[model samples]
Target: MTNSHEKLRMMMIIALFAALIGIFSQLIIPLPLVPITGQTLAIGLAATILGARYGTYSVILYLFIGATGVPVYAQMTGGLGKLFGPTGGFLFSFVISAFIIGFILEKTRFNISMAFVANIVGMIINLTIGTIWLKLFASLTWEAAFLGGFAPFIIGGIIKAFLAAWIGILIRSRLESAKMLPKKATIS
Candidate 1:
């Protein structure tokens, strides 16, 4: 395929995945501090599968839409204001988390379990930035921040992390079977 065609196709795929992330970013079920949604799965899975370049771009596109007041954020609301809202830190953290996942995956030869662990690591990155920002922005104590952000979602995050990693492995295996990746991609 030509470079132009590849570029267009890549753009379409990125847009499609970003839109999916945006759409799924809704369905907010309240936890302790922040709302939980399916968006992180999309982010982590996309990062693990697409590599850092496309994954980072895909998340950046998602954030751009949200910042423009497109209601692509969790709870179906958006605007630059959301970036500074109670849960804003996590939103900003998404960029780095995506890049981290993609970068680590590319650098390390992780098995499927490892890829999921990588996804969890990415989520931890998000939480780290988010909780700190939350504590600072809200002037809350560590306990308060934990209540609002991290503690409430530990179980859920664990589940999501495991699922994302498992799914990543499944997808990687399928791609390998289809001859889209090398046989050694599994690293099993």
Candidate 2:
């Protein structure tokens, strides 16, 4: 493909992933402090496929849409208020987490094990930032913040991480074999 075509394709893919994140955000399981959502899974998938730069761009695009009151967040919530709410840290962490996961996968040989480890590390970053935000914003004790924002989601996070890693690696492998993946984003 020509350079222009490749750039266009990359842009389109990033936009698609952004839309996916928005759609996944709606799949919410409500809780008192923070809702469990499929946003993380989409994040992982985007990172695994798009690499660090584009993956981060995809998430930023999603956040921008939500901040503009697109109702792309969990429970169909959006607006700047949502971005600044107690759950906002988690939302913000998505960017960093995606970058981390993508950078790791892009730098290393793609494999299920490494993907799993990358996802777990990303999840840890999310949880840590979210927990701190919850405690600060909600004026809760550390224990309370952990219980409300971190504890309940542990098992679900692990499951989602594993699924994301497994599915992402599969898709990536297929794309690579088909020569559809961008050379810049793949291991040469």
Which candidate's TM-score is highest? 2
Clashes of each: 2, 0
Model 1 quality (TM-score): 0.88
- TM-score to true structure, per model: 0.88, 0.96
True-structure lDDT of candidate 1: 0.79
lDDT of each residue in 121-142, candidate 2, tens digit only: 8899999999999899989999
How does candidate 2 fare on TM-score? 0.96
Off by more than 4 A, model 2: 186-188
Q: What RMSD does each model have against the real structure? A: 3.5, 1.5
Clashing pairs in 1: 33-148, 116-165
lDDT of candidate 1 at residue 127, scale 0 to 100: 83
Report the lDDT tens digits of candidate 1 across residue range 77-152. 9999999887888988888888888777778854677677788888898888899989998889988997788877
